[model samples]
Target chain A: MSAIGDGRSMPTGAGLFDLPPELAIDTDVARRVIAEFVRGQLRQAGFERAIVGLSGGIDSALVAYLVAEAIGAERLLCLMLPYRTSASSSRTDAETVVERLGCAGELVEISPMVDAYFGRPDTGLVGAAGPEGLTASAVRRGNVMARIRMTVLYDRSVTWGGLVVGTSNKTEALIGYTTIFGDAASALNPIGDLYKSQVRQVAAAIGVPETIIRKAPSADLWPGQTDETEAGFSYPELDRLLFWLVDRRRSVEELEAKGFAPGLVQWALKAIAGSEFKRQVAPIAKLGPRTAGVDYLYPRRRPGSART
Target chain B: MQPLRIALAQTAPRLGLLDENLASHHALIGQARAGGAGLVVFPELGLTGYLLQDLAAEVAMRLDDPRLLELAAATASDGPAGLSAIVSFVEESADHRLFIAVALLEDGRVRHVQRKLFLPTYGLFDERRFFAAGDLLRATPSRLGVGVGLTVCEDFWHLGVPQLLALDGAQLLVNVSSSPGRDLAALNEIGLGTATSWRMLLRTYAQLTTSFVVFVNRVGVDESISFWGGSEVIGPNGEAVFSAPLYDEGLYFVDVDLGDVRRERIALPLLRDERLELAVRELNRIVSERAGQADDSTSEPGAEPGLDVAAR
Candidate 1:
């Protein structure tokens, strides 16, 4: 493996100074700034292709479009994987986008593959249960499906010479609504910074399908499932509370004064606080002088500086 | 050789809120243009939040939508000296299947669009439940005097994408991604790690291919998954040129000389020394071994999870 550069020591300010003035206010400009940065990185890294899972959802849709603009559509590869319960409309929507973009695409049914591996009796009833049991059997089954999909994606990625692009976002991250290694896997991501409300804005601007942009958010792991249904709170309310609490680092009391429901606020607080572990890499034991998780914290190089 | 200035736009996105996301893009694009960047890249599914579950189909959009054209126009106007950008979106093909794709805009026109080839189905992802995988490997010629190999996130991990691009003489490889952050507790417990290991592997391949590699990841939480914004750039020699912080939205930029890639390839001779046929055979052997070890069981058709028992 090549020596990975620890960014902790890199100089922090040169690139920001040369940035465009409009970028400060323009969300598109902000996105462009990030895109240009990634583009340069690609040039430096010597990679040539990108691969994304087209889930026919707004998140994946938005990511797909941004990638097309950053690189070229020719270098982009889209994959549509459908399961037995997955709506046909979703696949239709995915195809529509692929055709309009003029990119190449294929379809793979995960049902056959997943069933072949984990649907066996020995795999346990957990593979076929719904969300009602304390066993969380349905969740486990869904997770299996998700991991199986990732495995296929990774395998295909190895064959295709491209990196897997993740499609997760901020709201989900805060609430820990994602599977550990399932949809959470990817080589890179572009929209993880934005909240659920913000994601809708960008999607509309880029002309994502109206249905995708307007529908209530859900993971579709089980029938009639919506994100809010499981989380017990809507995104708008959740985002407001999250911004105040997590982004502002406000105390629970401060959040209550903001007029949020006490119960909801408490829930959000607990969820966010409990999920801190999801935000970091592996914890390190203090054995060496410069343990990555402990003592190595300093800016080393400028943004454009040559590698040491 | 003039260095290529590339920007990775890490921004926030609202679930099912396309209009808001587009406005955000407008702002980000302006920033990249003002920064004198030749190209800008955004995250996979940056236009929409990633946890759409069943709503993915309802919100899928077509490429010819007027809104997309407007974005294209913006790209043409905002770029510096023939500016270009890579934008991610859900495209509706003629056959009506939804595809996760990236569109390249140059001189205000849609240059080329590539669909993702790998549809992830496990964990927090169920792309197979929603999308169609893409086929074909081709580089798009950019006005910037370089041929670029474009692919969405999952495509970059496969060797075929890079091999084909390098074989076709692409100088740069750009991948737009939406990688989720890993849970530290899970990593500690499982010890299997998150996507970083995979990213390192990608960097190694890029070095082997002797082409510049740019990876742009998104940040923030969407549903149960957290998008870890650890976007980075790797040199042809597999050295880290730049990397963004984890879980924060920012525009990361790097300047690179394509000439260096050519020189590196000449010096190392890895691509030349590659035995493609033999490698394919070895790959087959490895795959067969894994498949043989896998447990095989057929799921009963239409075996819906017992919703009654589940609701309990």
Candidate 2:
């Protein structure tokens, strides 16, 4: 829908440069791979079902389809965790996926959880609760909403008997475009390897609604907030750059040689480097010879005989 | 040279479910045939599934087992011309020892059986404990004007497997694997996930060997392991022509020209420059020589005692 500004074309290199068409992943192969990943991650974690925080964005919608396909629709729980500021269309779009897939769906307004910390003045829980008690910045409030949504998803995981499936794509994950423990916290992520552009491709191949795919990419943190406009980078352009820079391991000079603008390349590389910590497990000191997450490397399905 | 139509079947095999998996092979072989593929490559232990600790013996199939004949028969019907398949399974050797093996089935019978040379034993892989390692390495010739070299999952990870296959005149290298997707979503230094690294390796092999590499990995979770099915067909130039998705199961097809192998070999003569004889001679010397007792008497002048020429 909203393609953002005139400069948006600069990043995508739509007219100036060509996105390597060959790098566009074969979607049929991607679907089967993701479906198996979902099923495998769940089975390893001893879960037959999955719970996804459906934001009605393309990423979540694609993940929902993959999780449903991996197990069955009946085994999936789609939670529309919306804040008061979340758009009505967000709820409707999420509901559409639930209805189409015939999976269980529930809507839990996150206003109470968020407002409990920032909504009240007497609830002196955090610093910088302004004169009226709410955090002044939209960014700060957005982070709270994200964290609350994750809390609800994990809490639901107990009763729903499913792993929390992540929806963040490779583009966002690389750019540190996701909330640290919020949308990033999941038992298994099937779409994390796919770039945002590839996410749209695989989403279309898997039959996600066109409306969801074409809509302006956003985290819906505040009214009128969109990802592209705020980040000053278009996903298509960013995905292309990331594919070459990260996946292809191309240097900034090589990217420039490939016709990418120098400024955009620097910005993307810095974003990727800065966010590198988010993509890894928290470092654990190896006090012992075989510390967990160190030499004590075991698969998610270890003690395999116990499951039987 | 004729272009080879190859199919990589990235399927999830249920553990020890030989009957069901064989039927699955039958269906997939038909699918590949219908898609005009001359050869269909399935994942490692595709018939028995991975993480088969005790179950490996239960599903161990003999080379002459009737189930294999049925699979060979699936390629019998009218479909693609010169259709053949390399399917992986646990083999019950004549001596009753189990081996992880790939069967080259064509013309309604078993053509050749290539067992896994390296049985991985580290981290999530207990293959060595359950199965015997194979010592032989060779390639099978196809009627479609291409020599097909077959290797089980871990075989390709070890050095020299690709070189050995190429030396034996293999233009196409097919690696069948049931490699579980560990750290499925975790990114490595360059931002590639663990599963994606597998594709990168296939690309490197294809490029270095000047051969078409068909890497078919299984999809689905077995016990606590989830096999990341990113089956791919890498061109001789190391470019990925087709790659199946991360954890899904299906038959993916790619048309690889055997002529490209020749062209690439001519263009980048890595294989042509290979010193196979030198390597063979050195390996023969190393394996045959026994470790001599420490002798300081024949030591070189001004040399350390352990570094003596007599020790060498």
Candidate 3:
């Protein structure tokens, strides 16, 4: 948790519970900015191609389209890694995006990796099958599936000759709704700054399929699982609170004054504070004067040579 | 002259988006006005993002454009009292040529427009292909009762523009730029970077001309370049009084003492002791007599060929 000068864990910027109309960005500006970011980040690393894990969700669909626009469809590779329990429509939707954008894509089955670890019932693991040996909890199976999918993506990265582009939006990132080292692993991200609501808006502007934008967001971890259903807070409400609390750095009292429910404010504050670790680099004890990532730092590029 | 409150709106402009960028300018102007600034400055091409290779014509606007007028009217008495702003944008002249220019607005109207004299075409800059060079150089009368000289990016690098403006009774020199940041490692210990050479140049100009220097630069990555937003205000004594954080957007308010302009000039006497007539006559002689021979490596080109160039 951040010990923000006032001992509160929040970022800077302010907003009310009701999403402000001004918060809606000009889509043209967003498209140009994101496209430029993708191109610039790749060019700096001396690469022109990017790979994305397409989940058939709004976030991944938007990212796939943006990357395709940045470095043409020939350079972008969209990989659909679906577990056995994943919905058939999700797979179909992912294929639809690939067809729409005309980008190269492949389906990698993640069922083997997930089932190999969790199929056994008597492991006594946290999310292992119960005494009846029926099934593992949804969280455990989801974590395994996420890690396996990332592993497959990274392995493909070698042959694909591209960096892994991130698909997590600001809302998921702030609430720590992503699996670390799994969906969160990426060489660079273009939409990390945009909130989920803003992501939907930009998706429409950038021609992400109407079906993808209209559907409810889900991690596809288990059957019938959706983000809003599990979280109990709608994205619009959460995004508005985050815009005020994180972006504007409003105090708890200020949020309450702006008509945010006390319980929701506390819950969001806790989530944001608890997830602070995922946002930064792992800390290293500074035994030496010039510790790495501390006093000793260099830019990604230098005069004599490029980084890669 | 009185002490003037100045605000430097260090902002990132979206490339080739005129309407959206103007909206950003308006928002920043409101913030500056709320901060009690009498004058606010924006970065170069603040109204039409930088790196506009071919889009310059698409977004080029005239001084009297209705959108600019709308921005000007923001400083009305309904907000802050007597607020004035200097914002940069691509300008389409009467003849349809485009020039990178800055507009000075006050009392709900554009009071002056200073076009960039030097169009940098080296390294990451390719301004010459898209923008025509401006020939005029002078200062405008600010509502704060001081002559505020305006420049855009490379114009200040020549050393002659600010000097000429100071000689023309300018008390403050403002340069709006879209300088990209490099050598970022050195910026922490010493405020120096690839683009920060302009900062040292401004400091020297402030020391020599005894005028307040205001520089506002944009931040954010564009294509492959990242503009460093180390917008700053230098006192007439060449010391920085206020500087915004690099790589971030902020509207920083600073109080500039115009009295320093008079105080430093009296102490240094650089402008007062200048041999204006001799310098002018010698420049004209060099231009007329040595026009061709100058590039041909003549032994004695100018009327005062043996004279030390710096002494003038």
Name the best candidate (by DockQ): 2
lDDT of 3 by residue, A1-308 (tens): 12345443321122212223434554554565567678767765678888999999889999999999878999999999998779998999999999999999999988766656676444544223344333757776677678888898888887898889988889999999988888877888888878887787678778888888878789987788899999888888888899889767899999999999999999998998999888878899989877766755433432222346
Docking class of 1: incorrect
Q: Please give, for residues B94-172, the per-residue lDDT of candidate 2 as tens digits.
A: 9999999998888777888998999889866777777899989998886657788999888888878997898899988
Q: What are the lDDT scores of the predictions, listed in order?
A: 0.70, 0.79, 0.80
lDDT of 2 at A69: 87
TM-score computed on alpha carbons, candidate 3: 0.53
Compare the candidates by lDDT and give the number of the best one.
3
Q: Tell me each candidate's TM-score.
A: 0.47, 0.59, 0.53
Candidate 1 on A1-308: residue-level lDDT in tens?
Answer: 11225422221112212221111122343345345534443443345677788877778887777777778788778888877777776788788778877776878889876555445444454333332322446677688777877888888887776767788888888877777677877766677766676566556556676777766677767667778887798776777677677656778788888788899987876787887776556688888867753545311111232222
Listed models, DockQ each = 0.02, 0.11, 0.04
Pick the winner on lDDT between candidates 1 and 2: 2
Give the per-residue lDDT digits (tens) of candidate 1, residues B1-312.
Answer: 857888889765655557778888888888888887888998887786566544456557788888788888887753246568888878778889888888888788888888999878876667876788988678888877778888787787676888778767677888888776542211121211354564676688678788888788887555445566778888888887887776567887778777788789889988888787897786665555445643223323342222112121
For candidate 1, the per-residue lDDT at B243 reads 78
TM-score of chain A of each: 0.79, 0.88, 0.87
| Model 1 regions more than 4 Å off | A1-308, B77-80, B183-192, B276-312
